[model samples]
Target: MTAIVARPVSVKLDQETRGRIDRLATSRRRTTHWLMREAIQQYIEREEKLEAYRQNGIAAWEAYQASGLHVTQEEADAWLAKLEAGEDVEPPACHV
Candidate 1:
C-alpha cells in the first residue's frame, strides 16, 4: 500500500465560528482537525463543479454563435414541460 503525505496549515476562525465547530466536533466524536478537513474538501468539490458548469456554458454559447443553430424558446419550454410531467421526450431539433 502507498503511504499518504500530509501537510500542516494554520487557520484563524472567529470566536463564534470556532465555538460552533468545537461543539459540532464534540457531538460527532471527531477531532476539530477532521471536521475542518472535511469542510474544506466539500467546499473545494462544490466550487470545482460550479466552475466546470460556467466553462461549459461559455463553450456552448461560443458554439451557438459560430453555428447559428438553436431551438426557439417555445420549443424548449415544451420539452421542459414534458420532462417535468415525467414524460420521456426528445429535445427539440436545433435550427437556424
Candidate 2:
C-alpha cells in the first residue's frame, strides 16, 4: 500500500456556514478540518461516478449512431420481467 501525502488548501466561507460547521463538528466530536476534508472527499467521489456515467452514456449514444443497432422497448421490458422473476436469462439481441 502507498502512503498519502497531504497538502494545505485554503477556502473562504461566510460566517453563517462556518459557524454551522463548527457547531456540527463540536456535536460530532470532530475537528472542523476533518469535517471539511471528509465533505470534500465525498463530493469528489460522487461527482467522479456521475462523470463516468455521463461519459459511458455519450459513448453509447455515439456507437448507436454509428451502427444503428438497438433493441425495442418491448424486448427490454421482457428481459427486465424475466430478471424480476428471478430467471437468469441473457439480454435480447440488438438489431438495425
Candidate 3:
C-alpha cells in the first residue's frame, strides 16, 4: 500500500462556526479535522460537477446558435415522457 501524504492548511473560523463544527464532530464521533477535510472534499466535488454543467450549457447554446437546429419543447417533453413510461422511442429530430 502506498502512503498518502497530506499537507496542512490553516483556516481562521469564527467562534460560532468553530463551536458548531466541534459539536457536530463530537456528535458524529469524528475529529474536527476529519470533519473539515470531508466537508472540503464534498464541496470540491459539488463545485466541479456544477462547473461541468455550466460548461455543457454554454457549449449547447453556442451549437444551437451556430446551427439553428433544435427540437421544440413539446417534442422534447413527449420524448422524455415516453422514456419515463419505459417505452422505447427515438429522439425528436432537430429542425432548421
Candidate 4:
C-alpha cells in the first residue's frame, strides 16, 4: 500500500462539460479530480522537455564561445552542407 497526499481545489465547469465528466467518471469508476491531475501531470512533463531544450541550447552556445573558436553563419552552413552530403567529419577532440 502507498500513502498519497491530496489537496482541495475549486474549479468551475459549464453544465455540458460537467455532465460529460460525470458520465465518464461513472463509467470508469473514477473521480473527475483524478483525471484532471493526470492531464496536468502530462502537460507539466511536456513543458519540462521544452525547458531542458532551452537550457541545452544556451549551454552549447556558451561552450562554443568559451572555446575561442570563431564560428560564422557561413561556416555553420558549410558544416550543415557537409553533414547533409554524408561526409564523415571527425568529431572534435576533447582535452580532459
| Top model number, lDDT | 2
> Total clashing residue pairs per candidate?
0, 0, 0, 0
Clash-forming residue pairs, model 3: none
> What ranking of all candidate models by lDDT puts the best one first?
2, 3, 1, 4
- Tens-place lDDT digits, model 1, residues 2-46: 999998998988999999999999999999999999999999999
Rate residue 88 of model 3 by lDDT: 95
> What residue pairs clash in candidate 4, if any at all?
none
TM-score of each predicted structure versus truth: 0.88, 0.93, 0.91, 0.52
What ranking emerges by TM-score with the best candidate at the front?
2, 3, 1, 4
lDDT, model 2: 0.99
Q: Which stretches of candidate 3 lie over 4 Å from their true place?
A: 1-4
Once superposed on the true structure, which residue ranges of model 1 sit more than 4 Å away at CA? none
**Per-residue lDDT of model 3, residues 18-91, tens digit only:** 99999999999999999999999999999999999999999999999999999999999999999999999999
- The digit string of per-residue lDDT tens for model 2 on 1-96 reads 999988899999999999999999999999999999999999999999999999999999999999999999999999999999999999999999
Please state the error at residue 72 of candidate 3 in Å: 0.4
Clashing pairs in 2: none
Query: What is the lDDT for 13 in model 4?
Result: 87
Query: CA lDDT, every prediction?
Result: 0.98, 0.99, 0.98, 0.80
Which regions of candidate 2 fall more than 4 Å away from where they truly are?
Answer: 1-4
